[model samples]
Target: MSETESRPAPSQLRRLPWSEDGKSAYLSTGDGASFLARMADTMEEGMLTTAEVDMTRALSVADEVSASRAELKMAVRFLAHAVADAVEVARLRGERLGVDPEAKETAEFLRRTLTR
Candidate 1:
């Protein structure tokens, strides 16, 4: 007997579940999602590291010279804003790809930096 004749038709495959809100959420009952989540976490970590490095460099520069207090504060504020922007972009990218980004790590880094 031919393979097609021996097996069930394409329509026999079960339909995937859909969310009530109509968001096309993927059922990650598979290994792919776990891998992707790790990838997203790694990516976000890298971006966060880069942002921290940039901020640290600016902070160092501010500490070096006799910059006015206002100028130093402005520079630090700008660096913080840039870090926030990077975090949002990273998180959005991960979410769109059905992955969970390293939100806690990034937030902790930002918090510690700001506190110091």
Candidate 2:
């Protein structure tokens, strides 16, 4: 379950996949070790990988001086999607970096929650 970015407490929110309605989704994690957190990490990695491929293909097409208008249009579309994916990856990494990995409170909280 993800709370929208419009909510408060940015440091605690990990960006998740978009909702069915297309709104951005976020997860509140305890020590960032839960199944959901791992899933989010995997998703973020996938997004970046796919974005890299998309950007590479788009650049290749754009570099071709003789690219047809239709080809250029497709490249633009791909580039736009790649940029959007990168933005989301940045947001997720930013939020994660803001968290202090050495924070005892988070570790203790996760330990308690997991054992219950």
All models: lDDT? 0.60, 0.80
Candidate 2, position 43, lDDT: 84
Model 1 residue 3 CA deviation (Å) reads 28
**Model 1, residue 115: what's the lDDT?**
93
Once fitted onto the true fold, the runs of candidate 1 whose alpha carbons sit more than 4 angstroms away are: 1-33, 66-82, 85-116
Q: Extract clashing residue pairs from model 2.
A: none
**Tens-digit lDDT track for model 2 on 1-116?**
46664455766776676664687777766454899878877888899899999999999999999999999999999989999999878866856777566665787699899999
Count of backbone clashes, every candidate in sequence: 0, 0
Angstrom error at residue 66, model 1: 5.8
RMSD of 2: 13.0
**Which candidate has the highest TM-score of all?**
2
TM-score of each: 0.37, 0.65
Across 16-107, the per-residue lDDT of candidate 1 in tens digits comes to 22234775323232334466456555655676677777787678768878887877877788698667858665545544454334766787
Per-residue error at 9 for model 1, in Å? Answer: 27
